[model samples]
Target: MAPKAAVLVPCLLSLLLPFSSLALTQDICVANLLLPDTPSGYPCKPKPAVTADDFHSMALAQAGPTLAPFNTGLATATVKQFPGVNGLGLAATRVDVHVGGVVPLHSHPEGSELLFVFKGSMTAGFISAESNEVYVKEVREGELFVFPQGLLHFQYNTGNETAVGFAAYSSDNPGLQITDYALFGNTLTAEDAREQGHLRRKIGGDEAQGLLRIAEILKLIKVFFGLSAVPPDGRQDYRCSLLWTCGV
Candidate 1:
């Protein structure tokens, strides 16, 4: 009788686990784009206001322009662009890189990224935070690679043809922090930029000095053009010259 009681209790708990999980995830919170966003996500739209259009976007089906310099184009579908994914904790980007092009060094502060390659080939890598070691691989079509959260990573198109890939992030708004732009294109003081952005550790002394000079020049350019120091999306614009010169 005692053995039967133990078996029955274990079986009952196992049966209830799925129901408990389902209950937690059963309801979907569609995003209300007009409302102010909170730390967790945007406020949920009223159920009556929600429509099927909230769940789709034609933007992801088209390819972005791949021009000179970096020769890489990225089309992102985030909560801001696709409100349907609001509070869903997931978003995606379509990346197209021409031969000899690179996605550059960048990090996502809020999410991990999983890259799925569907065309051509590329070399992708990320720096490990625990060991500070670089983990790199040559990935081809039908392969996938992962860049862990908050780690600096990059992808380069190594093949002669174009490379196409999709990156899925763990957050609806995965903040993109490009290494060069963060170091040289923001409102930070030169000293603060160097210290906080780790510019000294990443580049040569001459290069760092050049970047500082360029940053100063860009500040003047912004003032001359009457552009806001920070854009509505909270990211400072990278100067056209900087983008062309750095190939980022």
Candidate 2:
């Protein structure tokens, strides 16, 4: 009977091992933003020190400045600003677009996005990387559209009035890269840019036309960043040739 009892005790302990381990494991990892970020995410804040405020945020309640050429305001709330979302695969953005405004072509390298239009209408689209095919649609109020991860996408206010929307991202800190900014807003010199454009033109045909389009877009980006001025005739007037020269 003693041998049987000992065996039963060991089996019961083994069965409870996983439960005990889970109990000790952390269920939430509120971010410690002061610490440097890691590959996985930010380090967890002290659990005892965490409060309900850590999980709540109003960062996306207001619209950001729409001073750029796109006339789009973006209020982003990610793990960096909302510490409670740390280790949680979620982030959000409030988008406000004026009439004739656009979000411009951009990509989220780390996450896909779901954009829901709650006011007015927007024309949203994404370009496929493989085929370069465009998938576009007019999304109105109460409708939603999706953009796949790592694909270039844009939102334009095609409606008569101003448009507003909210975008939810799959990543806690989805990285954003606007195509025009990547091409023109960098610290590269104009000479370097012209050289790159020349090389792309050497490919000929549509590639050459694409390079031309990039050149035209460069002026708009430069103006948005205050690196250039817009003449009364609406032509691009360059004040500086090099981005680094302007101490940007």
Candidate 3:
């Protein structure tokens, strides 16, 4: 009888082990990332198969290339190339801006962005025409800043050494709208782009183009903010939609 009992106990333990493991992973989430092993890279595997090892890389500690301001913040490991960012819409990595390197004035319309300083100093800000204010702020190592979505913003390296930092965006596919890139490249009118007390200072006139795109983007954004309606006459009444709306 004792020998029979020992064999039965082993079988029972095996049966229960699978159940315990399943219960542990019932509601956990994971991002699948593809890490590059060469000068170029490959793609991500399935998300469920990803280990924590794929999500964290210490490559930012390596010596940087001579690409100057834009080259240092190498995003070769970003969400676009890695599948971990697919559904979450959040991705980040490090940056190294040489002294006097400027990230220039830009905004990410799809989401808010923050830069965490690993080393060095810089200035950052956002300009809101509707709010009629510039939200410029300075930051150094161990500091951070948040730029609200759709606001025009910029960052400049102020450190004697190369400025290094971690940049995180709220979206995996964040749209980078540089103030200067928008105004001059497009066919938008300056008269149509003017704000209450502001005419764009030319970043090749892309600032004007950047501001022009805001009207429609902000309108959609307004809807999510609980604004009742976007008036038909191109005006911002902010009134609750009465009777009906083009929105419905």
Model 3 C-alpha lDDT per residue in residues 1-248, reported as the tens digit of each score: 99999999999988866534221333323333335421111233555676766556554456445432232344434555544444354667566766656665667777677789877777777788697687777788899988776678766665678877777877655667655435433454334555611466543455665676675555544443234254455654322122113222
- Superposed model 2: Cα runs more than 4 Å off: 1-25, 193-226, 229-248
By TM-score, how accurate is candidate 3? 0.50
Of the two candidates 2 and 3, the one with more favorable TM-score, higher being better, is 2
Q: Please list the C-alpha lDDT of all candidates, in the order they appear.
A: 0.76, 0.79, 0.56
Worst 10 residues of 1 by lDDT: 239-248
Best by lDDT: 2
lDDT of 3 at 152: 80
Model 3 segments beyond 4 Å from truth? Answer: 1-73, 185-248
State model 3's lDDT: 0.56
TM-score of 1: 0.68
Worst 10 residues of 3 by lDDT: 239-248
User: How many pairs of residues in model 3 come into backbone collision?
Assistant: 8
Q: Sort every candidate by TM-score, greatest first.
A: 2, 1, 3
Candidate 1, residue 118: lDDT: 81
Pairs that collide in candidate 2 are none
Candidate that beats the other on TM-score, 1 or 2, i.e. the better one: 2
Residue 129 in model 3: lDDT: 62
